[model samples]
Target: MPYFAVLYDYAPGSDPLREHHRAAHRAYLNETDHGTVAVVATGPWSDGEPGALLVVSAPGPGELHAMLDRDPFRLHGAVAQRRIRSWTPVTGPWA
Candidate 1:
């Protein structure tokens, strides 16, 4: 498996939308939060902002896309921008 870092930028005034889907979002993440093909860690970049960083593991880009495509926030038009990249960890607790 390879690591993929996902950056999600959401539209403004989407707070309500995000809150509405918070449970489902968290549930999904918690259910698949770690393993060979799952979300490694995720959270908001700052307060009162809809930006998030999700480090995940998957076989390739296709699987990554498929996994992220199901995000409740993204499905409801909360996400304005999404960037995914392959990452190579050199050293650290997560390495």
Candidate 2:
């Protein structure tokens, strides 16, 4: 199964928003299961940075979009840019 990598670039100084949405965001990720086809690994892009990476898995773009639509940030209009791309892993757990 192919995977997808979605990068989210949040606006600067959005801590309060992030804090408020933390639980909901995490819950949203948990609700969308990656199973064997997908996995989500997230963390700050850098110290005090507002960027995050939302790694996902699916067969195609449609599936990816559907998943993104359910994300808490999207629902609350807090996400800045949501970039989606198809990924081919040459090595790692999935390999």
- For TM-score, the strongest prediction is 1
Q: In candidate 1, which residue pairs get closer than 3 Å at backbone N, Cα or C atoms, i.e. clash?
A: none
**After aligning candidate 1 to the native by TM-score, how far in Å is the CA of 86 from where it should be?**
0.8
lDDT of 2 by residue, 17-63 (tens): 77899898887787645433355576668775667786677778877
**Clash count of each predicted structure:** 0, 0
Look at candidate 1 and tell me the lDDT of residue 74. 88
Model 1: CA > 4 A from native = 33-36, 47-49
The TM-score obtained by model 1 is 0.88
Q: What's the lDDT of the predicted structure labeled candidate 2?
A: 0.73
Q: How many backbone clashes does candidate 1 have?
A: 0
lDDT digits (tens) for residues 21-70 of candidate 1: 98998887778443346888999997756699999989999878877888
Alpha-carbon RMSD, each predicted model: 2.1, 2.4
TM-score, candidate number 2 = 0.81
Q: Candidate 2 at 15: error in angstroms?
A: 2.4
Worst-scoring 10-residue span by lDDT in model 1: 28-37
